[model samples]
Target: MAERTRQNNGNGKHVWRGIVIAILAVIVLAAFISSRKGEVPVRVDHVTKQDLITTISTNGKVEPMENFEAHAPAPTTVRKIYVREGQRVRQGELLMQLDDADARAQAARALAQTKAAEADQHAIQSGGTQEEVLNTRSELVKAQAERDSAQKNYDAVQKLAQTGAAAPAEVREAASRLTAAQAQLKVLQDKQQDRYSRPEVNRVEAQVEQARASYTAAQDLLKHSEIRAPFEGTVYSIPIKQGEYVQQGELLIQLANLRRVQVRAFVDEPELGKLAVNQPVTVSWDALPGKIWRGEISQMPYTITTYGTRNVGQVLCAVDNEDSRLLPNINVTVNVSIANKKDVVTIAREALHEDENGRYVYVIRNGHLERQTVEAGIANNTRIEIMNGVQPGEVIALNSMNAGTPLRPGLEVRAR
Candidate 1:
């Protein structure tokens, strides 16, 4: 019994010892792993500066250089429509015509009146012929003779009434006749005075002028019935149809001059300051891939719009479209080279880092990676200009290294 108890105690002691040894082994193994982790080298990359040309990209739209809206000059019904949308037209080409029946009638009436007035005016200016003048004189003589005979009869009747040989009624009737004859003689005298003074010609000339003015107004209204293109262009839209009633100044069609296309692009305000007139620009359209259309800055909007995703100034560029296939409102991409430098030091943009202090970069020296502050300028999406604190052919770390690891200014590293 004593031997068995002693054996069990011995076995318990051995098990405890084994447990302690296993625990010690685990601790030592963990310590070894920690030491190995500390010695693991971090992976990094290098960067070097090179010359880069800075560029700005923006979305723009293609537009026509000139657009015109045709409108009805007066209220009328359309009689004829001569052109369709997209039809090429020349200046002075008849686009449409309005019903001009009333206008024509008015013009005809006015023209006849004008002709009559003109004839009267000519007669007045050329005065009466010698034969006509003589005839007028003869009529005046006859009127004078009639007046004298009536006066003689009136005087004789008055004398007879004083002698009671003529009735009072008869004497009154004779006096009325003499008064009528004297009135007639006065009218003849006035007519003679006008003819000699040419006053009648002046009155006729005034009548003729009034008729001529009416005629001219009627002709002008008639001309308005025929609508003509004001300039050479393509018809973009036609809103009215034949027999459609249109009010004055109503839009009829849209005409656009497509000889040259204009692109309207919004440039960043910061970039606008660098742009100038005649700056060369490259334009691309998704509709026509691999084709680059050349253009130049033609105009810049004086006003700035604050409503877009980015507040920018509007600029207009004129592109030569000899083929005339380029139309308005096409989506376009514009790449403008704002600045270019030759043989200048530049670095990949990813290699640069910044904090509150300013711009900086990670540089490797003697196998050690260190953060070096840098001055940057004219950076683009892919690259940045290293103005200072960085040299050409110097390797720079692209990402942050583990601080707890043994990374220092002179530590060796393998790029991954």
Candidate 2:
């Protein structure tokens, strides 16, 4: 029994020793793997001589260079819409017609009032109307005749009195009759001369002027009732339907010359300094995929404003749309070409880094990273122009394959 127990103990000792040896082998292998991981895998690119284009992209809205809008001249129903929306109309072509019956009636009433005022003004200037002047003249003539007759009777009575063929009382009575007739004639002449005072004449003239102005306003309203295209343009908006009642000053129609359009681009504040008038611009609309319109900077922003969460400046670009496909108020993407350089030393933008010293990049040489300071010129979203410090044909590190790996000087790297 003692011999059998010793045999079992010996087998147990061997099993423990094998298990310890296997654990030591695993520890050595793990150390070897850790030493290999010191060299980090990184993305790399070659600095090459190529054309570089720096552009600023932002959102914008289209607007017409020349636009027109019409409103209802009065509270009236729309009589007819002569031109449909999107129809091109020539200058002086009628676009819409409103119910002008009221307008015409108003105009007629104004005309009648104007004529009456003018007649009154003329009568006041001439002392009276034609009929009144004639009546005054007739009365004056009768007074003059009566005065002459009285003078003749008075002279005859005086002569009789001198010849003792007339009594004194009769002569006196004839003189009194002559005097009364002369007084009546003088009064009529004074009445004609003092018919209208200065204030009265001025009041009448003012009335005439006011009436004429009213007539002109009425005529203007009548003309506007029939809306016409003042210039050649496309009818873009017609808010009122035929026979629809609208109030005065309500919007009715809108049209614009769409051959030439303006793009109001909202550029972020940081990009404003890179913009200038006459810079080339390209615009694209999501609604029309793959279609691009070319333009130039026509105006620069005078002030900065908040747009959503970003501070932006409004830049205006003039674009040619001979086909008129770019409509007003359509949202579009605008790309302003800030710089276009040819045959320049360029590198991938991800390779470039900046710190307190200056801008820099990680140059790869002999499987190791070297921190090289660089002067950058024009840059786009994915590429940058290296003015100096980094020459063409040099390999540069973009980033590490592993997120936890950081790039540093003298660090060993394996290009991926």
Candidate 3:
């Protein structure tokens, strides 16, 4: 029994010793793995020389450069509509006509009055017209004859009354007749006294001038009845129909010269300051894909205003639209090239960092990260130009995480 017990005890000791050896090996392996995990694994890409661009993108709308809108000049019926929407017209081409019957009658009446006033003015300036002066003289002669006859009868009646051959009533009647004739003669003499007076001539001339102005105004109104195109353009809109009555100043026709198009970009206030005249602009339409229109900033915003939820400024850009595919008032997207650099070494924008010192990036060299202060040139949304402090063919770390901390100088990194 003692011999059996001794053998069992020896076997137990060997088993415990083997177990301790396995535990110690496991501890050492775990420690080595933990140390390896301290280094951050990062993705890296090498900088290369390529064209770099910086742009500000915003929404915009199209407008016509040369546009015309015609309106009704007065209350009248549209007698004829000669053009429809989307019709091309030349300068002086007739687009519509209004009912001119009333206008023509007005012109005729004004012309007759003007002629009569002119004749009266001429007569006053030259001692009256020949016919008027002759009639006046004849009227004077008739008045004189009547007055003499009345006076002779009154004298006869007075003589007869004195000799008791006529009644008293007869004598009074004769005296009244003579008085009436004398008054009539005096009125005629006064009328002929100032036939060519200055005031009379001036008054006649003033009447003629007033009538002439009315005649001219009526003629102009008559001309307005025929609506003609003021310039060469395309008729884009016509709002009235034939035989429709329209009030004064109502919109009638809209014409536009679409050879050139203008884009009004509503840029946010933060981006407004970056805009300048002659900056290159690219436009794209949602309705059409894979198409682009180019232009330059023709005008800058003079002030800021609110558009929708954004405080924006309007920037006007002019573009060539010879094919006329870009219509007015169409909404579009615009990209303004604020800066550009070509054939330069560039890095991912995610790799850039800034501090009080300056802008910088992390360069991967010898399996470690080196902090580099770089002068950046042009930057787009994804990438940026490295003007200095970094060279082409050098790898840069995209991101580094050290136990929830950012990367810094001398940080070991494993490239992925």
Candidate 4:
């Protein structure tokens, strides 16, 4: 009986060991299958022959062709404004008016003074007329007749003194009076000559011209009170209201021409050499997405700008706008195509990689990843041109991979 019991215990132990071994084997198989399922799958794309375009992209703003600020020319109170903000205006259209009552009064006074001066100048230029000359001559003749009578008396007195028929004191008094009369006659003759040729008249003529110029200046100021638009444009802003006092050079309104818009963008110095006049460009505004406006490079600034660790040069592009949607200072994006190539080997931009040895890519050969050194050319945001070391229809890995990542040239790979 003891021997039988020992045999049964041994048999039970052996059966238990066998069952445990089978369960371990099943667990190992299940783990191997789960590990295979957890492995990360890589994605890839194929190189192909297609047209490749290289473009430079940057953000910009749309600005009007011309922007101007209108200011008050002189200090005055606003009388009336004909237009409001955002109003369309034509060249020479009246915009605003200032109280010009004082200006008008001043101008009138200046004109009156100018007219009086002119009349005085005309009279001076044309010296005394024939009648006035004759009148002066008559006065001179009368003075001469009186002087002749005095001279005769003096001559008679001298003869008496010589004959000793009168006192010497009386003869001396007569001689003094004769001398005064002759001096008076000479003064009259000189006065008559001055009437014909008056030199002072020319000085009066200069004063008249000065007064006329002042009058013209006052008239111009009065006209300037009625402000007019300088060019055809839309009114952007109106800062002044009627009865508001504005100083000289104060902001009154703003204007801009919206028909033609320009995009001002900056380009790096390295890319500056690739830009030229009339180069084709494509522009899109943030306000109007999916709408590309075609344009050309209109101007390139000669000087470079330095701003907070950035060095760039300015480039201006002229865009045509038929709908007049583009306004001043609207942000935009620009794409300038620098070059294009056709029938070129190209791949997605994600396929290219860089390291210490320079640019490289991974190509699949015989179902395995193979390292490839490539020379790249013009690249756009989507694809890059493969200049050399690659061919068309070749499979390339899209994502980056490690060098010692257990990849073989001919090993089978399941591209995700």
Each model's total of backbone clashes: 6, 0, 0, 0
Which ranges of candidate 2 are over 4 A from the true structure? 1-38, 148-179, 198-200
Cα lDDT tens digits, model 3, 1-416, are: 99999999999999999999999999999999987786788878788899988999999999989988877767889999999887889999999999888889989999999999998977776557888778888999999999999999999999999999999999999999999999989977876766666787888889999999989988988998888998887887787888999998988888888777899999999998788999999999998998899999999999999999999999999987776778878999999999888798898888888999999989998878899999988889898998899999999998864457567788888877
Give candidate 2's TM-score. Answer: 0.82
RMSD of candidate 3 to the true fold?
10.1
Q: TM-scores across all candidates?
A: 0.59, 0.82, 0.69, 0.69
Error of 3 at 153 (Å): 28
Task: Write one digit per residue (lDDT tens) for candidate 1, span 1-416.
Answer: 99999999999999999999999999999998775653425555444545677767888888877888767766878989999988899999998888888788988999999898887766444445556667767888988998999999999999999999999998999999899889988877776555545576777778788888988888887887887888898887787888999898998877888878898888878778888778777888788888888878889779778745788888898887766666777778887767777777788787878889898876776655677899888866788888899887788776535566544445555455
- Candidate achieving the largest lDDT: 2
Question: Using TM-score as the measure, which candidate wins?
Answer: 2
Sorting all predicted structures by TM-score, with the top scorer first, yields 2, 4, 3, 1
Q: Sort all candidates by lDDT, best to worst.
A: 2, 3, 4, 1
Please write out the lDDT profile of model 4 over residues 1-416, one tens digit for every residue: 99999999999999999999999999999999876653334578889989887888876677778877867767789999899877889999998888898788889999998988877665544435556667767877887887898888888988888889878898888888878888988877766555334457666766788888889888887987887888998887787788899898899877888677788877776788888888888888777768878888899879999744768877899987666676667777888888978889898898888889898888887656778999999888899998999898888877534334444344445576
How far is 58's C-alpha from truth in model 2 (Å)?
Answer: 2.7
lDDT of each: 0.79, 0.93, 0.89, 0.80
Pairs that clash in candidate 3? none
Poorest 10 consecutive residues by lDDT, candidate 4: 400-409
Residue 141 Cα positional deviation in candidate 1, in Å, after optimal superposition: 8.2
RMSD of model 4 against the true structure: 8.5
